[model samples]
Target: MIVTWAFGHLLGLKMPEEIDKNWQTWQMETLPMIPKQIGIKPLPKTGQQLKAIKQLAHRKDVKEFVIATDAGREGELVARWILEWIHFNKPVKRLWISSQTNKAIKEGFKHLKPATQYDALYESALARSKADWLVGLNISRALTVKYEDSLNAGRVQTPTLSFVRQQEKQMDKFRPQTYYRIELEIEGQKALRVQNNPYEIKDQQEAQNLIEQMKQHSGTVVELSEKTKTENAPLPYDLTEIQRTANQRYNFSAKKTLSLVQSLYETHKVVTYPRTDSKYLTNDMKKTMKERLQAVANFAPEVKEYIKAGATVKQKAVFNDVKVTDHSGLIPTEQRASPAKFSNDEQKIYNMIVSRFLTLFANPHKKLQQKATVAFANERFVFTQNKVIEPGWKPSEDTSETTVQWQKGQKVRPNFSIKKELTKPPKPLNESTLLEKMEKFDLGTPATRAEIIEKLIRSELMERTPNGLQVSPKGKQLLDLVNPSLVTPDLTKKWEDELEAIAQGKFSSNKFLKQIEQDTKQLINEVKQSQKKYQDFSLTQKECPKCGSFLREKNTRDGKIYVCSNSECHYHRRKDPKVSNHRCPQCHKKMEIIEGKNGAYFRCKFDGITEKIPNKKDQKKKMSKQEEKRLLKQYSKPEEPEEGPLSIALKEAMNKED
Candidate 1:
């Protein structure tokens, strides 16, 4: 079988500028430039791959082909687009496998389905991409033209920005109200008063009067209750859950964790697909569960005991086919991996997956919970305590405590005091909480959420702070200016639902495209009529030499640039060292071309080495053919092997063989 691959997507929908001259310039008159015919073009980076695929597809010997890309919507698009672009007429089959394990791949190949089976999936993927292009491009251009500033709007990202901005607005308008509570201490043990609205006395005088009255009477333990509760082991890691756990435990960003897990899957072949949305495996996969468990136990010996004790007790909770979709849960494959072979980040992610898998087999955690109520002056106070009965799956999370025990009808005098407290605002969005909110709102899919967040940060629309993500002034302004529908999560939910329907063949792609076109036009019209204004916060006193406009400092993922604030002028200059194609002589890695006051030189960021390249006027002349030949010969001469103990032994063995 011929194995060929497209670099993700070899073709993309044509941009507005490519469609017509009128759409080339951002103008209100060109608002909502819906293409008469959506066309595809080869992406610059995928040119070689496209050429190779075309060459292979047209080969006379190659009578058939198999599509073995990812088994998801976007993955289907990546394969189908190339075939469409090449107009391939071969009999095509589909290889739909979720995990990268050899066994899974073999099974998928054995039961190859006809390419027609996934036609609806391809349509759904195409519809989603075209809709985004039409909506995001049109609205972004309209906003940039209307505000006279470079701004971006998207179907998924704008709504996410609104989430942050909404939280900030709520915080800004929040009023901290002071309230009072009474805490009674009996024999150095504290208990809080139990009320319908616990300790929320708004008036200080009333709170003081209640405290004084409570002090006048002795306390009695009115009730004591105790019970044992069991907490089931947590479900396996979906991409989102694992990302949040990695962030909380190792401070790894969601994007970083995703990258690490993807590497573990694609490079090491030690884990299943990393972009899966499901957290449960199919029932059929239960047959291999013991092998997978053994592989994990080999790496994490702490789980071996459970595996030895029979780890199939909770199969119902973990292996339900109904809960699985495009892919099964994130899991370790049967391939045994040496932790030493992985990088530190990779090791952390791998270990987390192994630990979570092991926890699924372990027993449920059991705890004894206690509650006590005390009465004084007709007021009741409650105390709570917990003690661990069993350290089950997750011993690290056990938070058992010991407290002074009290029985029913126990009486004692206690000191009473009123404590003041204030209401607090909602916490800012951390990567974990933000991801949770995105999942709840269906803002983006598991595969795209991290990229969406990174885009917002790259655009300087949001800033990552020590506490959490804070909305930038620009992000808030963008949220204020955009149409409410574009900034509400409901739009994304609607589109996502329609996309799923299209995938199921219940909805038509053409109908979805028509709706998107109408929405795009409405969004543009809203932008053209809105009276919102935007200020360039990055503008500086420096003037652009080409445009005679104020220069604005822009920070990009790669580096920084200074560009004219005038959107029309579009003058830009690099403020950071430019990455060069030249390789370093020492490290053989790409070097950066640094321009200093002295001259231009290539510097290796990895090794802190610098080499000066001669100016055109002072460059050395080329050597003659005879001189080149001599130099080449001198450099290519082979040296004799050094006589060491190991080398001598190897020479003696070779001589003996001769």
Candidate 2:
């Protein structure tokens, strides 16, 4: 058997112009450019690898092939596309396995399934690719051309931006409400408020009346209850869950976390695949649990404690075959990894996986809970406290201490106080909370969510702020102009559900594509008939002299730049002043470099002066012998030069100075 690999996607769907000549220009007449059939072509960068795959397929000795890419939807598409492109009619088998450990590979080869079994997965992937092409191209062009500015709209990116804008709108319309709560103190223990369900009073007078009635009143402990509470150990880490935790704990962006975890998987070979959505391990993996634990014992010393305690018992919560999908949850491999070999970021991700995997074998956290209720007049005040009985899996759990003894019907004097509380608005969406929202709404798959969020930030529709994510002015305007259905998550989520259904063989890919085509036409019509106008929020005050169009300003690390807003006009220039080594004669400071119709020159903005940049070739050229001799004869003999008109003028000037 021969083993080969591809660089992610070796072939991509053909561009609009490559598919049809009519869609070459960005005109409204070609709006909603949907091809009757979408075709795949080889990507430029992987041409050599693709050629090699083709040659290997045609070799006489190679009779059968095995597709051992990632065992997921996208992976199926990758191998299938390559095989179809090469016109290979040989028998094909699939090596589907979750983890890449040596044992798993050996087992996968023994049970390789026919590649035809994954046809539904390939069909689903193909349908999604075509839908995105049709919708993304048609809508992006329509918006950009109609607005005369660079605008981007997409099925997933547009809705993701809308989530930010929706959150911003909620914050803008929020009103703060003031309320009062009554608190009591007894024997130095703060008494809680239980008379009001939420312990809040909207009326200040009502609060004052209650305080006047209860002032100087004696309280009795009417009820006392104590019970034991146990919290189950948390399940192992999924990609989204770890991303959320990393974001909150380390302030790492979702993309950064994914990149780090991917490195740990691909480069370090310590963690399993990082793109899994399941949180449970397959039952068959239970046999390898001890070895996996022993592999991380060096890096995470605590794993040894769990192993000694026999904590690796397979609980139904952590090990179940039904919950696992194409890949199991991310976990540590059986290969031992040295901590010193990993980068700081890689170490962080690797530790997270090892830590979460260990938790599966830990005991349930146990705590003692006590609640005491005291009554002053008709109002009841309650106090609750929890003490950790056993730290269990979470050794870092905070333990609350209590020593006071209380009996039912005991009398005591209580101090009452009124506190004012104000309701605050929701905070802006950070990456941590944003991932949670995306997962909750099914906006994108675990593997694709990071990319979708990055696309929004890269396109400038959303920006990262110190507080959280905020919608740009362009993003807000996009929400107002796009078809209303495209702005909400429901529509896209429905399509995602259908795609999953297609993968399950319960839905038809052709039907889904036809629906997408109809939807594309309606979206295009809405964009065309809208009376709303689009304003270029990034436009600068400067205008293009050649095209008479406004110049759009963009910030870069080097400096700022101004580009012509007109799509047809190719005009752009740097806005920052270029400081040169040449010094200004008046200011004696470095001069600004400027290129003009005349040539390169140095300009001093403060002194309002300009100097031509001298050519080094002219200055360094050697003078001929004839030219040197002529100059020497003209100036060496003053008596011969005084007779000449030019020499007489120079002598007159010298006599006047004397």
Candidate 3:
């Protein structure tokens, strides 16, 4: 069997200009430049991969092929498109598995499914890619032309920006209000007075009256209750959950966590697929659970102990075929882990996955929950306490507290006091919370959400602040100028629902594409007709030398640049003076090297100092120790030499040293 791979996508939908030259220039007349025939073009970088696949497919010995790319919708597109482009006539089969364990691979090869089984999935993937192309390219071109600035809009990205903008609006509109709460200490146990709205006593006078009454009267324990509860071990890590946990624990961004986990999967070979959306495993995988446990025992001895203690899989909680799709939860593969061989980030993420996997087989956590209600002056107060009965899967925290035992009809004196507090505004969406929101709204899949967040930051539409992600001025303006539908997550939700239906064979791709086409046209028309105007906030006083257009400041990953505002001109220049590794003699800091008409010189920004660099030919040179000693000896000699052969030899030596 021949093995080959495509460099991501070998073929992509043709650009507007590739279809017709008239559409090349962005103009209102070419507002909705929809292709008459949506043709596929070979990507510039994939020619070699495509050629190799074609050569191998044409071999007489190769009768049939198998698609063994990632087990997801995008993976389906990555392989199917190559075959379509090459017109490979060989019958194809599909290899689908979750974990990269040898056992899973063997089982997958033993039961490879026909490629026809995933035809609907390919259609869904194609529909999504084309829809994004139709909407994103058209709308982005329209906005850039209408606004006269380089702006972008997309089905998923816009909605995500809208989420941040919505949060900002909420924060701006929030008004803080002061409220009072009464804390009562009864029989050395703390409890808070309960009301219709627990701590929101708006009237200060009413709060004072309640506090005075509670201080004077003795309270009685009117009701007491206790119950034992069991909390089963949490399900294993899905990509989103692990990303969230990593962000919360280590402040690792969603993109960073994804990168680390992906490295553990593809590079370290210690973890399963990192892009899976499911949190449950298939029932068929249960037989090899102990073996998988044994593989990771060295990394987690506690888990090994649990397994040795007869820990068994919870069938109902963990093993469910219906809940799994494409791939199972993120897990440790049967490959033995070498913690020292991985980077710190990889080790942290790997440990997280292993911890979750170990917890799945451990016992459930048990706790004793207690509640007491106290009554005084017709006011009800409630207190709750929890004690761990068994620290099952996870390590238990100490919850023991000294409290007076209370019973029904018991009397006790209580001291009460009131504290005033102000309402707090809603917190900004951090990467973790934003990811959760995206997951809830189906804005993007697990694999794409990190990229979406990164795209927003790269576009300067959102920025990372100490508190969380904040909308930039440019982002706010873009939101105001774009159509409302594009900014709302509902559009993405609708598309995702339809795509899932197509994947499940309940909906047709052609119908979905028709709807997308219609929507794209409407969105473009809205942009063309909108009354909103966008001010180029990045515009600078400097003008481009080539185009004589105003230069606008733009930021790149490397540094900032000033570029011509006119898209066609595309004139760009560095904004900051280039720094060189050559150190300054005075301050010893790296000096900024500037080139001029005359020559190159070094300038220091810290001390406001400048120094000239010597010409290479005239620069001072160091002499060797032997040459220095010889020169010193020659200089130390007397002016007159003795009239002898030895004196003559000494004179010659001195001349040579000179």
Best of the candidates, TM-score: 3
Q: Write the per-residue lDDT of candidate 3 for residues 1-658, one digit (tens) a residue.
A: 6778775678888898989999878888887877757778789988888989999998999988899888899999988988888899889999997766677678889999999999999999999988998999999898988898878899899989888889989999999998988888865667778878855688889999877877687788888999999888888889998999999999999999999998888777778888989999888778767777888878665767767866577535789889998888887887888888999888888888888888887778878888888888689888787888877775656756526676888887767777788999999999999999999999999999999999999998889998999988888899999889998899999999999999999999999998888998899989888999788889988989997889999888868888888777967877987787656778889998776668778888888677787665544464545778999999989788548998889999999999
Tens digits of per-residue lDDT, candidate 2, 1-658, equal: 7777897999989999998898888889888898887889999888899999999888999989999887888888899989989999999999987667777689889999999899999999899888889888888899888887667888888888887778888999999988888888877778657753553589778888888887657788889999999887777889999999999988999999999988887777778888889988888888888888888777556778877876475335888888988778999988888888988988888888887777777778889888888887888888877889988778898966765677888886768888888887989999988888888888888888999998887777888899999998988888888888888888889889999999999999999999999999999999999999888889988889889988998755556778898878989888977788667889888898888898778999889699887788864585645779999999888564337788889999999999
> Against the hidden reference, what TM-scores do the models get?
0.86, 0.86, 0.89
Better of 1 and 2 by lDDT: 1
Tell how far residue 268 is off in model 1, in angstroms.
1.1
- Write model 1 residue lDDT over 1-658, tens digit each, in one string: 7788876778999988888998887788978889978789999889888889899889999998899988899999989989988899989999988777788789889999999999999999999999999999888888888887778999899988877877778888988888888887765667777778853699889988887888788888888999999888777799999998898888888899999999999888889998889999887877787888877766656667767776574535887888898998898898778787899999989988887777777778888888888888689988877788887776876575766767899986777787888887777778888888899999888988999999999888998999888888888888889899988899899999999999999999999999999999888888888877788678889988887889989887668899888776878878878998767889989898987789789999999899887565554474545779999999999998778999889999999999
**Which residue ranges in model 1 land beyond 4 Å of their true spot?**
175-178, 186-189, 202-206, 396-405, 417-422, 566-571, 574-658
